[model samples]
Target chain A: MKVLEQFEFLDDVRRMDARQVIYQFLNFCMIVASALMIWKGLMVITESESPIVVVLSGSMEPAFYRGDLLLLTNHHDEPIRAGEIVVFKIKGRDIPIVHRVIKLHEKEDGTTKFLTKGDNNRVDDRGLYAPGQLWLKREDVVGRARGFLPYVGIVTILMNDYPQLKYAVLGCLGIYVLIHRETN
Target chain B: MAVLTFMCFLSTYYNDDLADVNIKVGSVQVKNVADFTTTRERKDLAIINNLGVKVDLSQVFNWNVKEIFLYLTAEYSSDVNALNQVVLWDKIVMREDAQRIDIPSVDPEYYFFDDSKGLIGNENVTLTLSWNVIPNAGRLPRVQGLGSTTVKLPSTYAHSSGRI
Candidate 1:
């Protein structure tokens, strides 16, 4: 009976490492905070709300696949040109579209309107724009694509497509960190 | 580790096989049309004449290259924004066999009108042939070809073609 009690007490102590638990929790929080800070810093440097974007569709087939990743930069003073790929978000839409600029209309007031089309697509993006919106304004542009990597962003796509998988992975990570005690 | 090696291999592979690009601005026709398709208030706009663009992009093809998106642009200076650029024509080359493009007399692929009505009286506009190299993997880059021509638009407005 005494041996069993001692075993139970040892298990309890091992399960509830108070100092270790607090340290692990704080480490997790620090990681999350640093990630956020880095993302926000990138936004400021790139002058784009989302400096990095994952190619979500094959509309820009042959140029960008569904899983590729694109790096973007938005220079407010820079003049936009034709044939350049730009990522723009339409009004009332959460998803952004990446396409090449097919046309540019520079107004006398220095504001320019852009017309975009996918290289694989036959028709222009007139139908993709908002109702009564003939052209995309400068304000509507998210950023211009500067660089890209192939298929690294598939992880993001997988996470979004399978919420169960995402939850499972996240839960496993959390549990592992919480239970893991530093063997110093 | 495999991905890193592949990326390094791709970056080292520099295939500069683009032979040549030739573009000829056939004519510049100015017209005024009242169309509901465009939101422009001005009825006067520049109608680009069919371009005689001959390109041998066969050399630009490689194992990593997917497609070449070529566009003909009319770049000119204006008081509005210091530079007024518009895409007059564009073509997508999926394969090298489709490289020899001979469009005898065709309108601009998209609208060729300028926002500040700068297309009219825009003489000495430069026409350039540039292409965006789409790759199966690695970085996508825009390359400007050596083919370029100058077009001078007549000051008078030509008769309308009744089409955009």
Candidate 2:
């Protein structure tokens, strides 16, 4: 059976020399490092710490849905405007909320205050802010919504929602990578 | 799959040949409202704006555009603040339905209130229309209107039955 063959392959991998084990480990490390490098490169190009984001909720509705991937950009020169969607994080919250900038208040300083609201909701996002926080400061904004792609980020969302599934996939991938030998 | 997705994302765009837009600001009046945002005793200055706009965005609805977020903004220079842009009104144009929007005369959809209560006799105010084209799989590009108008608020408060 395929399972028996996989077991035999695992046995063969265990019998391999120490150099083979080190080589496989180095290959795995290279894969992880390159993925991190790619992410960092994207961050640098987009001018945002979090260059890519997945839509976790349906607040944006007909335009964006759950599992949709969004590209973000934050420019220092351009101030945020009304009707443009923005992704921001409150002081005490870890999750970022995506909403439209309904109002702008520029202060005596150059910093502009932002009032945001969800398009599908009936009211503004005053309730979503921190207990004492009224307007979002410039630093609170992560980025403005620039590009969108639908339904590709579902794998990540699924993994997040189900820990067992995440572990299972990771375990399977690790085992497969370790057992399979590449022919050069 | 990745190649197809990238192609789909890159295919749609807002026309470089922009659409025509017209904005006219009628009058502005200042009123006092309770400051719900802050505990400051000073009443917030709520300016009532009457505006008229005609937008022909039929060309913006390409094959990939899902909707267009159209809004009218009031930009002015403040003594304390360097620049102030307030959104007075807005509407969503769905691709399946209408594209051109016309308003003979209408009040602002949202309240135009200043936190500092700065506008009382300010003469220099500019009104311009703008839109965000929402595509199915691409970047959201903002487009500015071609025409803008100047508005001057009256010195004193104006009382109307609807507000203020």
Candidate 3:
């Protein structure tokens, strides 16, 4: 009898009205959905697979440093030029590189080949290329750099550096929103 | 709201600065003056020199100009004043509109010439080439405001007797 009474009391306190529960759930979902929409919008406008990137290393130092944010756009019709900095992904590598184009070779079939070298490095990126591959094709390029923000990617870096802190922050935000009970 | 706006503005400002030029050249040279055909079958002149001395700009297809000027300045250790005089003479000759020469190309016509030439055979030879780019009105992406090359020629080329 005592156990049954305790269960009923606990259930009463824990239960929330359906409307209120639905309202909070919808609000959270909307916020997440909007973020995804904006990201997709950026992808379309930039015409790139990844429109935004964060500098994870200092390979492009003096021009771009670690924790910097980069904006990129790729238009297929536009020809790539030498001296311009571009961001590209190598196969099997999770991250991309920002480097300057040092050489370009156009073939008779209208295809183009390119070689890249970082500003701070002593040599070209031949070593970084895929096994036995010497040059980068147009498809390898993710996007050409249109612009960049300095050090604004520090938040991302911090989150990655401190995985525990990232979880703690997310936990705190979730708790705060749940307890505040504000209707928007 | 203020904080969000500030963040947005700061990000944009830094983004612009990050797009600045990052090319470095310890030396540059322009050579191999010969007519050739491009993949497009356009008549173009091939100048093979080492931009690869520091870095090569060969892959860049959206060149703004057809003709590029190669400015040369040579210095002699014996006479500093003579070096200045040579540069001054070359500047005068280069400034004359008639001195500009046309360099043919497949896509667009270009030219190359010395805007200023200084002494040869003393100490060092410094050359600057400013390309005459076809105006694209900034529509082209990442062009970095046309192109310029500076070359330091071999000390032997600075000799007064080396002129052709």
Candidate 4:
């Protein structure tokens, strides 16, 4: 019965006036564009390429659990210090690792080389880095964690873990928007 | 939830005081060891002896703070590197654990490895205590303690066969 109802909704879309269909399409586009604009604005304000990240591993346990949301800011003027949590990307690795800066060496020319370690792990992140990479330079750092929100990123994790649920949610939202009646 | 987090941040944002913390370095033993982790060259290894730390961090904890990551670092300047900061010891203070940290003598948790021979006879090596407050939902503020101590490494290095 639910499948038949959804098929009837598809028929309703076909029967709609061409002008009305265009208006609905334009509304959807407007929503997506505004979301993109907001994201870009945040990137500009924070000075970070990716301003937000979700904790995906338990290496930083007791402080940052899985599915926690983290706000990051990367300022070129700010020097990375010890004990500061940073999100860095290794060469050839797609996923960025979030760890705490434990050791740092700064040269006279203002270049800094540092080492990172997870809180729960016994050793530093040398094994996690690319082969022959002894130290992480300033360019490797993505951003420094500024703020945190717990358990708010569970929705994103769930969608990534279950593709069927993602499709179902997207399909339902699309259908609802298409059939939505404007009172104005 | 957003409002609550904002309110929590506002309440503790101005409270920057980390309370009184005392750190002392008794005797530092410096040795040269082969560096397999990084460059194949020999590295200066400094082992701290009779390290004493006492701090009452009970007042540092607020409702928003979940835990505190305490670390002791050795900061020095050398010809090899203008500035070198190596963490010698660290501890995690949970909300349920006693916040009053008092230790007369303790073993160093991590090795103090320098890329070059910076730790040998370094006269201006300063050991400072710093902490990062892990909040339930707010900014992660890193505040350094008020007190620190200096240690001078011996001019000669210890034997490599000595127990680390």
Residue B129 lDDT in candidate 2:
86
Interface RMSD, prediction 2: 1.8
lDDT of 4: 0.89
Candidate with maximal lDDT? 4
Q: Report the TM-score measured on chain A for model 4.
A: 0.90
List model 1 lDDT by residue over B1-164, tens digit each.
65874675376367554556677665577776654457646555676666687777767776666778888888877656566677777777886547666666645676666655565677768888788877765556777777678777778878766555
Off by over 4 Å in 4: A1-18, B162-164
Segments in model 2 whose C-alpha atoms lie over 4 Å from true places: A1-17, B37-50, B159-163
Q: By descending DockQ, how would the candidates be arranged? A: 4, 2, 1, 3
Candidate 3 Cα errors over 4 Å, as ranges: A1-16, B1-164
> What digit string (tens of lDDT, one per residue) describes model 1 on residues A1-184?
4675666534433665677668878978887789899999999999999999999998888778998888899989987778899999999899999998977767666778778888778788989999888988889889999877788899889999999989999898876666566566
When summed lDDT is taken over every stretch of 10 residues in candidate 3 chain A, the lowest stretch is: A7-16
Measured by DockQ, the strongest candidate is 4
Predictions ranked by TM-score, top down? 4, 2, 1, 3
Docking quality (DockQ) for each candidate: 0.50, 0.63, 0.05, 0.83
Q: Candidate 4, residues A1-184: lDDT per residue as tens digits?
A: 4675667656556556888888888888888799899989999988998999999999999899999999999999999988899999999999999999999999999899999999999999999999989899999999899999899998889999999999999998877877664545
Q: Show pairs that collide, candidate 2.
A: none
Off by over 4 Å in 1: A1-16, A107-109, A181-184, B1-6, B9-20, B40-42, B45-50, B58-64, B78-81, B95-108, B161-164
How far off is residue B133 in model 1, in Å?
2.2
* Per-residue accuracy of model 4 over B78-157 as CA lDDT, tens digit each: 98889999888899999999999999986787788887889898999999999999988888999899888988899899
lDDT at position B37, candidate 4: 67
